[model samples]
Target: MGTQFLTDEKGNKTAVLLPIKKYNKMIEQLEDLHDIKLYDEAKRDDDGTSISIDEAFKIIEEKRKAVK
Candidate 1:
């Protein structure tokens, strides 16, 4: 929602920014993708509600492979 200036070890700065609404939407999309993968893996049954970021990416990779 707000902008921030990040300084690297070399003291170079870059502005990072995002709108809160957009960020929330991105989070929701990631969560939905994770839920689908968990369901596929049988690690969740009948509407389970939590997922780790790592698990999400693994699922994403699997999905990507399938598409290819």
Candidate 2:
């Protein structure tokens, strides 16, 4: 493994070190997993309600105005 670790005086693993390429790939994979989880949750929460893009935009605009 192209991995290393930073240890404390007590030989405890404090931090990890990985190649920049590996770190980036890990981050991308985590992001993809997060997206999948969100999609699954949304599907589970679905109520069969549908809205057009125009109505969605209008609701967003109303909410933005309320925030200000």
Candidate 3:
């Protein structure tokens, strides 16, 4: 994607202009980065307990049966 800079009278770049598609892609990348940081922080925190996949599936099935 191409970028254009909005400059001031002094020839200093003040802002940037990018295509909407490029801007949206950048936003999505930033969100992904944020999610990765959250995951890293969760990994560092030892206080959280994790459940096995089998146990989780069983619990979900039980809930579905109850709803029906």
Best candidate (score: TM-score): 2
lDDT of 1 by residue, 1-68 (tens): 46566877887886556788877998999999999998787763535676888999999999999999
Span of 10 residues, lowest total lDDT, candidate 1: 41-50
The 10 consecutive residues of candidate 2 with the worst lDDT sum are 44-53
RMSD after Cα superposition, model 2: 5.1
Ranking by lDDT: 2, 3, 1
Candidate 2 displacement at residue 67 in angstroms? 24
Model 3: weakest 10-residue lDDT segment is 43-52
For model 3, state the Cα shift of residue 68 in Å: 13
lDDT of 3 by residue, 31-60 (tens): 999999998997798576887779999999
Give residue 28's lDDT in candidate 2 (0 to 100): 100
Report residue 40 deviation for candidate 2 (angstroms): 0.3
TM-score of 1: 0.42
Model 1, position 24, has a per-residue lDDT of 91
Residue-pair clash count for candidate 3: 0
For model 2 the local lDDT of residue 55 reads 97
